[model samples]
Target chain A: MGHNGKMIRKKDLTFLQKSYIPEILKGMRQTIAEMFKPKFTFRYPEERFRPNPSFRGRPVLVQENEVERCVACGLCSRVCPALAIEVQASETELEKERYPIKFEINMVRCIFCGFCEEVCPEEAIVMSNEYELVFSSQEEALFGKDRLLKSAEELKPRLEFLRLNR
Target chain B: MQSLLLISALKFVAFVAVVLLTVIMLVYAERRVSAFIQNRLGPNRVGPWGLLQAIVDVVKLLLKEDVVPRNAYKPVHDLAPIISIAVALSTFAIIPFGNTINVYGHEVKLMIADVNVGILYLLSITSLGVYGVTLAGWSSNNKYSLLGGLRSSAQMISYELSMGLSIIGVLMVSGTLRLDQIVLQQTKYLWGWMPAWNFLLQPVAFITFVVAAFAETNRLPFDLPEAEPELVGGYHTEYSGLKFGLFFLAEYANMITAGAVITTLFLGGWHLPFAENLGLSPLMLSLLQVLTFCVKMFFVMMFFIVVRWTIPRFRYDQLMNIGWKLMLPLTLVNVLVTGLVLLLIQ
Candidate 1:
């Protein structure tokens, strides 16, 4: 979307434009004015940024009542491009009948692509707004079921977003 | 005589300490001002408003390994930053910070050195600064460094002409080469109100001189030598640790000296307007004069930082064109006009 058209030649400039001083003064005034404008930088740790619901952060499994919403169908694990998700299905006495006995996510490999969330047949996995992820070692990066699961109330916004969109 | 020598030594120590401290503050100010202009908070973590960041940075640099490139010439590479820092620091000795005040029954002049040929000393000392950058570039054995050094030499030499010519306008008006005398000339009231500062008397010279100073100092818009995107740290590309820190210190020191020089020559150095009539004590007045000089120098430094953030670097051809075709001729004409006006008034 560009025109390979006429370019401004030196001769085309007016006396003011040719001088460069006026333009420089104009720019200086603009910069001086800009110095007073409120800054956009978050003071980071002290002042955290609250990202909008649309923002796709780290993927977390949604837990409802006393159990996770996942049916252990392996759809999410199969769809995870990074192969970060690991789920072991086991028979449950609850109404869902089958549940993941062992659910782990290698946070290091998780791309946060939301693909696993999209491919989930159950309304189980969703992207949460927890962007600050730091791990000291490879082992530290691996999330077990305890870390991976977020109570449905905690992930209400994301769950609601997925439900409304679907 | 011994007391005079001791006093001079004390002044030397005091001034160098102040200059070093100011350079650190100037670096921090430059970063903060640039960030403010760009709508971001820069380096506010190290201390209160990041005031101690530069001090911490110096310590960090000191602790880091002194890296020397395998292909680099050892002796000159070691010598360059020393030369730059030394030249930058020495230029400030001639700038009068206040009028002579009685200290312990002997009159002590405010500046470190009272050179009779102060202006000539300033010009010569500043001219030597180019050697440090040029030598740094040449010794590094890096193509980018060499280009930066070569550009710096060319820019400095070209701008030096206009800088000297512009100073001639001030010289003609003041009718003296001594910096203190020039300042004294400026303190006189024109029409009983406005100070007859060289900036007011020779505005064209002020403009040209300020422009040439910008070029000489290697600040942005005239910073072709250290254009980071092109030259990758310019002459200091191969320098690291303490050597790199010295160069950084020298650049900021050069800026302070330039600001001091400008304040001395044009803005009426240490001459706080109408303070003599305020009925203040001589000691208080003297202290206030020194304070005035510092405030003026600070504003000039701020202007330098602001201009750096505002203007984009000139194209190499445009830099040369401005230096030779525009600035040189303008300064020559300004000098001529100043001479004519002086003659007419007389």
Candidate 2:
């Protein structure tokens, strides 16, 4: 006979299995064993998960030499599906001629899709590992330029991961 | 007469308080056990190891707004939860937790009522519990509630027959409907080693009764009435706040009652092996016996929780088939065989 596609066969149950008691006992045994197994739950606020380089948390503007790398191209704002990011560009004397006078990301509106980071031409806005975002009021959730800026040293691992992977 | 009344009233108050406390603990245990079974730590935030979680839950429930549906039958809606809770609490009156204890130079029976027809009273009161569910469903005036109510009543009625019949084997052997007497009868041993509990003597009846108890309590494998996927909260769909809390408390209370009844009937209630030979004082012995009963009931409650997490819910048709075809016939056979064996021995 010629070999065809993989044929899956259902294993036949013996008298004990057919009776349901054995299977039920086996399941109960498994569950009781699982009860003693080590749990994977993190205490959350008190305990935090350290995300790897590829992990996309809040999008942040990389600050190198106490100056933001962003030229305020407005690419991130255009690519943001949620329209959460808003950038107002102004003239600057630095090598990057244009700088954001006001750059704000609405944390509540952000879906954390990493589109802003992916579309940033300057590699300025990159996803950091800081996932803890708590806001009691609407105004508090709006991340201004001061809140959005991160020291390049802090986001080195993510930048390295991006460089290596991309 | 005055003393008797006072004692009875005191017993009632004590029993109610104890039952409410047990219900709270049982809720906590259910969450913890279920979490453990699923490989998760449950509710360890409220107090040390989440001991105060139940209290927090009670507070939350109390603080919630009591929402009644606009088109609901207001009287029945209000009455249903009260009726459910009342029936659940009332059934505990007949369960003998321990033998008599001497308190203040007077002998007091551990149970609230030592009624001769204890088991019969239990069966009748449990049957009345169906009314609460049915009324809740009907009064909600929702299709899901109505269906849930109908399913619950049907399931209860079907399982109650087997549950009642299964006990006939035990009743015949023990020769009494009094729960305390049944426990007393279970104190004997067979072949000088094995305890002659009804569970060992009539295994078939025991299995049937346990299954029936699960169905009666609306636990998993028999929780068709409140099938969350299909019924969307089932009969208590329209219930909110304290009314929903009553239903929740009533369910746990019923579970505790089931555990107590099972302990009284099949397990040796308050009877520890070789305890009589221990030579302890009468007060100490009675206390130990009460402790033994509580331990047995606690294990039963744990078994209920474990089995709930272990098994999947049965489909409606499968539930009916098992109740009527499988459990009913097996119980009948058990009764017949028990009667035959008794006759032969005589």
Candidate 3:
């Protein structure tokens, strides 16, 4: 029985060696076929290749009226996962309203969760489809009131009507 | 003297044209090949099938800012890539791309210089390629750069031994160190069917050589030097714009060099499969031979791309073990076996 076991072991070794060469050849064949496989790179400038509508992009503040939607509620600041949003409010003449005097959203801190958009009661903030937000410095990443207001104005036309009514 | 000077100048210009054109087209091919493998469309928006993308890329690279890192060892860091690019361009001087052709009533050899020790010269210069990688890594002074340089040094030294050993088997059978002579020796066939390609006769040596060449070129599976995720840019993380472009250029140039060397040594450079002794005119045969050499190189290059996409990269330890344990021992045994066979036949 020991002798038979030794014979079986030797046969197994032979089989293993024989199997490797053909398996390796099979791998080579697969690689040759992959030479003709389709590539993954997308042409950026032309053919736009727009992402799906559900594709999450850079977040921007949506101004519902000529007034800022933040209303200094600070709920966005509270719910912010990255603590990106900051709101400094003061009383205003329009219906005893509180408006953010100094509003800033640090884009580097943004997780693009749309959480701030969901958390807003006034429906003032919504993230638009403008995903191209590349910057060379940290300062540029911190969008201040002026920059955010300008971006909000640019996105004002695209905001939904129900949110506008709110 | 003036006419002689003019002739030599023209030859130089012609070599430059071919090398530059090849680099551009090869870049395009690499992009297209990679795109195909990843299931995406390559640069098709430019000219036909993105042919002009390479030209546009070159122009853009040239016009881009050449930023030198403030912390870098400036002179050495700057010169390292230049040395690499120069060496890559210069190595072509010894490679014979085609047969003699007449231009302006002057007969010129296709090669720049066919030295007696052409193979050794090729090896020596090719080995120096590691220095560029090492210096770029070290000079950058970043931890990632330092690691990249250190890995490259170890990797190049380990693989060079195996690469050298692989060629020894071919040298023993061919009985020459000269590349031109090696090609001449490969012209004859062993039987009516076999094409005298060294790959058939010494499969072990061919495999070792090809694998070692992959390592030598710092290609994938052996591309630990620039392993991106782990090392960021690896040796060249600090370099930006055209300075970075030089390292990129050197990588492709080395790929081309490796392809050419493999073609000349094993695949029967420029010789047709089974068409030897047909009594064709020397000029006509030479032309056909050049075309054959190109086809072989192209096929080998495609093999490089395929392996790159198909195989996952080797871990550093795994790469080291394969080089020293598997490839080195196997190559040495191959060399010994080939030498013994040659001795017995003689």
Candidate 4:
């Protein structure tokens, strides 16, 4: 049978395969072997999985030198498919100009698609390796700038990976 | 008569307690074995290596809210799980766990009841287990539950024919229906080397019986009744809280019963080869035999769990074909061959 658009015919099985006994035995043997193999389970709470630099986790505002790198650019908010990010621009005394007076990311609505991070021209809203996002109430899930901001040192690996890849 | 009654009562209590405890541990073992087969760590949080997991589960079940559907038949829904568990637990009564032991001046058998028609009693009681599932399904007023119950009952009936036929070979070989006598017969060695286990003599019957037993217990490769992808939860879909817990307990209990049956019928019960030559006292020997039976039962249970993780559930039509088309005829052939051989030898 051709791999193209042609109709594929079923291959004739060997006597052993047709009988199914050999295949069954082989399967059983494989499973028994797997029983002795090392388990890949990570015991949560006691142990955590450390994601690589390429891994996208929770979105965070990169804080550098006692100030956020974001100039209140609404690009991240506009690109967010979930409509999770909300920003209010305000005048700033800094040379770069406007800053977000109030910025909020509804952790509940955020789909972790990294669209906000991708659209941010300022490189401020990058994904941080903080995957454990638990909130008891709807209000608690609405992350303000206080919770959303992370120091550049904390997000260095992801930022480095992004810069190298881009 | 009073003494005999008292002894029987004591034996019954002991037997039930042992079985219930084993069933609890067997649940934990099933989970752990399944996890190991899939290369994952199972429950290890409740107690030491999760030894107290069963206790925690029982407590959780007892505390959970019991939900009964408005449209469901209340009495039948309530009665179904009780029947399921009762039948499962009752099957152990006729299974001879060990030989007779002398204590002080009296002789005591390890089994609860030494019934003359032990195998017949076992088969009949096990057959009654289908009622529990069927009633549970019919009373639940849910299509999934009804379908599951119907499938389970139909599967049990189909496989049961093969199972019974397979056992006919064992019956013919042993020449006795009494379980203790069957075990005694198995104690004889073939040419002073290999144990005369029925598994050696009736390999085809053993395979068919094992396949049938797997179907009867509703384990994987034959678990079409409770196929989670199709039937949701089969018969116990509508049951919740301890009522659902009862069904879970009943399934594990049935597995243990199946394991015990397989061990008794084919693996030579508790008769260990060359056990007599150890020169141990009668009491010690009886204890050793009981230990042997438990060991064999444990391995059988492990095999059951392993098979569950190894094999995927069969399609409904394939399950039916295997039960009727394949296993039935094969067992019939096994019976005929065994009968012919026995006649020739005589």
TM-score leaderboard ranking: 1, 2, 4, 3
Model 3 residue B82 distance off true place after TM-score fit, in angstroms: 1.3
User: What lDDT tens digits, residue by residue, belong to model 1 across residues A1-166?
Assistant: 1256768788878998887888888999999999999999989989999987777998888998878998899988898899999999999888889999988999999998999889888879889999999999999999988898899998888888888887
Output the better candidate (2/3) by DockQ.
2
Q: Candidates 1 and 2: which is better by lDDT?
A: 1
Q: Which candidate leads the pack in DockQ? A: 1
How many Å off is the CA of B117 in candidate 3?
0.4
Best by lDDT: 1
Candidate 4: lDDT of A60? Answer: 93
C-alpha lDDT values of all predictions: 0.93, 0.92, 0.80, 0.91
lDDT per residue for candidate 2 within B1-346, as digits (tens), equals: 8888999999999999999999999999999999988888898999899989998999999999999999999999999999999999999999998888998877899999999998999999999999999999999999999999999999999999999999999899999998888988888888887888888888888878988999999998888889999999899999999999999999999999999999889988998988888999999999999999999999999889989999999989989989888889888988999999999999
DockQ of 1: 0.83
- Candidate 2 reaches a DockQ of 0.68
Better of 1 and 3 by TM-score: 1
- TM-score: which candidate is best? 1
Give me the runs in candidate 4 sitting further than 4 Å from their true place: A1-20, A87-103, A137-139, B65-68
Model 3, which residues run further than 4 Å from truth?
Answer: A1-25, A34-166, B1-8, B100-107, B274-282
Report the lDDT tens digits of candidate 3 across residue range B28-95: 98887777766767778779888999889888878899877788899999988998888787777777
- lDDT tens digits, residues B263-305, model 1? 9999999999999999999999999999999999999998999
List the candidates ranked by DockQ, beginning with the highest. Answer: 1, 2, 4, 3
Sort candidate 2 into its docking category: medium
Of candidates 4 and 3, the better by DockQ: 4
Stretches of candidate 2 off by over 4 Å are: A1-15, A71-78, A86-102, A119-122, A135-141
Q: Is candidate 1 or candidate 2 better by TM-score?
A: 1
